[model samples]
Target chain A: MGRIKLMGLAVSIGKVTERYPFAPVEVPDDYRGKPVIDPGICTGCGACASACPPQAIQVKEEGEFRVVHLFLGRCIFCGRCQDVCPEGAIRLTTEFELATPNHDDLHQFVRLRMVRCVRCGRPFDTYRHLVRSLREVPFIEGERLLLCPECRAKAPLDWLEGGGDGNEG
Target chain B: MGRSTLEGRFRVIDVSPDEVAEVVRELFEDGCYYATGMGVDERPLNGRFAVYHAINCPKRGVYVILRLTAPENRPSVPSITPVLRGAEWAEREAHDMVGVTFENHPNLERLILPEDWPDGVYPLRKDFPYNRKMAGTEGTAGVRGERHDEATMSVPLGPYHPLLHEPEYFELYVREDRIVGADYRGFHVHRGMEKLAESRMTLNQIPFLAERICGICGCTHSAAYCQAVEEAAGVEVPERALYIRSLMLEVERIHSHLLWFGVACHLLGFDSGFMHFWRAREYVMDIAELITGNRKTYGINLVGGVRRDLSGEKIQKTLKLLELAEGESREVIDNVVGMKELIARMEGVGVLRRKDAREIGVVGPVARASGIDTDVRRDHPYAAYGDLDFKVPVYRGCDVLSRFLVRVDETFESFSLVRQILENLPDGEIINEEYSLPYMEFGLGSTEAPRGEDVHMVLTGGENQVYRWHPRAPTYNNLPAVPLMLEGEDVADAPIIIASIDPCFSCTDHVSIVDAGSGRVLWRGPLLEGVERLRR
Candidate 1:
């Protein structure tokens, strides 16, 4: 019950604090920073896609190929996307410095990749490898297919005409 | 004794594990919700496995726990997951720890252990040796296992990694920063509480183990565990102990919410808010340390009664402190809520639709944010919450911001609740004389921890030792949502987004994510392997 308002007295009860902007605040050793993507090794499995609550990364796996398209604007920078990531392809960069003139520019990332297929413009993938030995959906044209390089070259018009990204019509 | 008035709604019907499916289905027909169930390890004694199923009827507002026991020779039962979706992880935990095989459980893969774990060595079974083995050398020690898909990649998160204070490892499937898939393996800080409780500790000594389970939610865990022991041991807490227990629970709520606010600020790149909230948090910590000897771990909870007393002076101090926190924290929280840019960034970002929250059974603020109204404190009140006046803060935004808002609002509500309890502080002996120790009994205790509902299932052996103690923290139930929520999100939002759920990494470990049962890494060698070949 022995307390008084600090403002009433000339001497403050506590030390005066310094401004953060005028000084470089010390970052902890374990500070979570920017995200880094390894283009060469990224599998585009979309665990980052799933782990990321923000839906910031678009990973399309049509067949053998996987495409990883990361947009940073939607990022909460939680590091679960990084932690849950099975491969070390994605690393949170030490740079947390993110700012941009345009909203879209804030979506910049360190990398993007297309795996397995070509003509469909999705990730490159082989259907046989995707569904190995599992006899579920049969018939090539009856079901959909990921266009390999040769198939894309053979029927460029047909592949490009009605072709949409996988999971798309 | 307060008899459950909802007895007409939920009559305790004894059902076997096999009958659990049919019994629970019938309950669902009666409009009962599947609250929670647990798998317990009962080995050496009868060499049997036990699984408990619980159901709740909101109209009646009561809960019932049903027990299932299977002999250790072939511990298997019909799966209830098909009937109740929430049963999936519970069954997996049963299989992972207690070694109960849920028959017809689709995707019956190990949910915690890595693929390479030595076969048939269940950890929680009472007879599993209590000594530590080699860490990295023995396959029994580490969670990593063989893989399939020919694309094996090991991405460790922590024992000391950036972006996390807890130690855990998540193996990743990567073509790049976009993690195609992952396996979460934790237990980096396995304090060996279970072994210590059963083998080394007595009935009186086990509450310390409960307190050590989590520093922040000490009262909740210890309270639940102790209540279970008290119920099993036939010990009755006095009405005054019950009221004081409720008071501590609300104080814990305030403390947890404040800590969460600080963590949330730290995640959103708001340093000032983080510092200010933590500074505010120091007051509550001071209050707790004053009441319970420890600063972080408050060991005030005891079975059948409280270890300390709350006099008029202590109650007045607590009331004044709550009032002080409420006045100061309101302005700071309002300023935080008014951070338009930060709020906008979190709004509608990281949405876990209501359907997924229920379907996957995400608990606490995460589920409440998504409009899933399931709180143990509210649905089935145990403490003063049953008697107190408070509203469950909920929002339908289902985003990171809504989660933040829920905690912030809940903080103020908790502060007010604390004041109300302190002002009307009941006076009586904190301990009940008749309930010091009765006989063998088992009780299920639930307290909403800082993160979510912490459920502790306990079976006691009267005065000798605890038969079994299973503490299922809210984080255990919420872990499955990570893979579901992380889908289609950017690599950048990894930190703040993961922090949004207010994750308790200590509670969960890696469950294997083998590519179609194949344990092969398709694309191996160094980073230069494929790239160098392409260049050549």
Candidate 2:
């Protein structure tokens, strides 16, 4: 009968279910799970924030700080942040046991100090981000990087006329 | 007056509003069936509204899309439902979502929106913000329960039934244990995904959202969406990427079919069969996780090509897993076919004739079982399916058993497809990023999902966003046939009959309230009693 064969198959397969809670389960090396950012290497460039589909990672300017917020609650585990991270600062670790009782536990805020514009005296780019940019493009004058994007765009016409050796600091 | 070709798979034709029905009727007569319909707000483009009806011409191996536009002030178009019955729900949906009026539609009620949703304020319009929250109106569109005089007893199946996986309300009018008429009301978990995709999500991000449309066959949605974008932008996906996409799709089919078999067995009270089938299905899931990192939502598809490539070692391991999955699945299915009790339960129950199947426009195994002989993979091949060889099993029984056998045959076919894809995968780049998006171009992408033909329509916009993106799942087309299948069938057979379509209600939000002539409530409970009666 079909029942006898099914019974035989069942007996042969034995217990297929895993003892997950009582015993540790092994996941594949390429498992996409909880994405964490290495704040030490991160330059607060906000590339991951712009690349995130769910907006789980967001960059905001808070007074003198550029805050990159990563909310685990809204994360769909797509690993897109890791893909777009310029400095390899974000990595999706195989740590998917992210259930929590407190809402604050799900949030990770990486706050970087912002650099003030030389002319406007307003918070412009993050200090580390500007430094990283300067490192990448070393030919650009550091004094130009000190000014905000708005101030840099509208620099003195006299400086443009004397472009050969204007003001080097 | 203009005609154009979209990626060589779709032929687009623009028609006036009056000739829309006639053209769709002529196409229907010419061996073409309704695939899907979409309504777009084109006020921003050319100061008019547009409606698109996509029909599949199996004989020609192309999908002919009939497009018609109406003036901004009078956005009205002729209804094609009178000619092709399958266009009923789709036209009503367009009316509800985009504020387009389908003149002479039989029942153009609120198909997608909730009863409390205010009228005349369409959520998919150009002006409506994606995150806008409107207060529920007082009795705007209340449920109209028509009292049929013939049926004496009214039996309500769900809004939440033990048998159903998702929330759906089905009202069955029964007279002395024989069902007379049935009505369905669903769409509880709409989530406003289309609105969100058009308004907020960019080109690449929509693929992730599309993958979440159906929990079981999420990859097919993502594949279809990516294909639509690729077609619009004319991106040349590498040969290796195509093979990988097909391989992953077959793997997904194997797991989805096995899952359906387990659920079917559980519904039939054969718990042992259910457990064994699920046990066998684990191998396919393992293979998916090994390849795509995640098991269910294999988030590998993007606009140009796939995100991951199959290395030699991974391909070897996948073949091993496929061997195990195919062997175990064949053993269980062979045993299941020989079981008289299980066969008797499904044999002649819930019969849907070939005529009704065509009129309803069913797809996948359901249509194949009814002898319609249509498969999107063969008729209009996509995602490396053109190079693969497989058989689409069809049965003329037009019953539940036929459907089961069709899927059984398909599971084996999928195994062969996986092997072919892995062995013949070309060496090249996995993803291509060199393509530019054209403004206001239409594209269609379709995949033969486990349930049926899953179609996604995309209208490309500037700034990396879709002007309108409509995804029509297989369940949307197949669910309309359930009421007809339930009619004249025994009350006890309702559960399996509905499940026979492999109905993914979440993929469908998609139904039930029973009203008698006297408007009296008789039985309000699960259909466990009917199953108990049948068991006795």
**Candidate 1 Cα lDDT to native:** 0.62
Model 1 residue runs over 4 Å out of place are A1-169, B1-13, B16-18, B25-37, B41-47, B55-60, B112-117, B129-164, B170-183, B436-440, B508-536
Error at A148, model 2, angstroms: 1.3
Model 2 misplaced stretches (Cα beyond 4 Å): A141-143, A157-169, B1-6, B140-147, B509-536
Distance from true location, Cα of B432 in model 1, Å: 2.2
Residue B51's lDDT in candidate 2 = 90
Give TM-scores for every candidate, taking all chains together and pairing residue i with residue i.
Answer: 0.67, 0.94
Clashing residue pairs in all predictions, respectively, total 80, 11
Q: Write the per-residue lDDT of candidate 2 for residues A1-169, one digit (tens) a residue.
A: 7878999989987888789879887778889989999889888988898889999999999999999999998998998888889899999888878888999989999999999998889998888888877775435455577778788777876534534443222
Report the CA-based lDDT of candidate 2 relative to the real structure: 0.83
Candidate 2 per-residue C-alpha lDDT over B404-443 given as tens digits, one digit per residue, 9 for 90 to 100: 9999999999999999998888888888888899998888
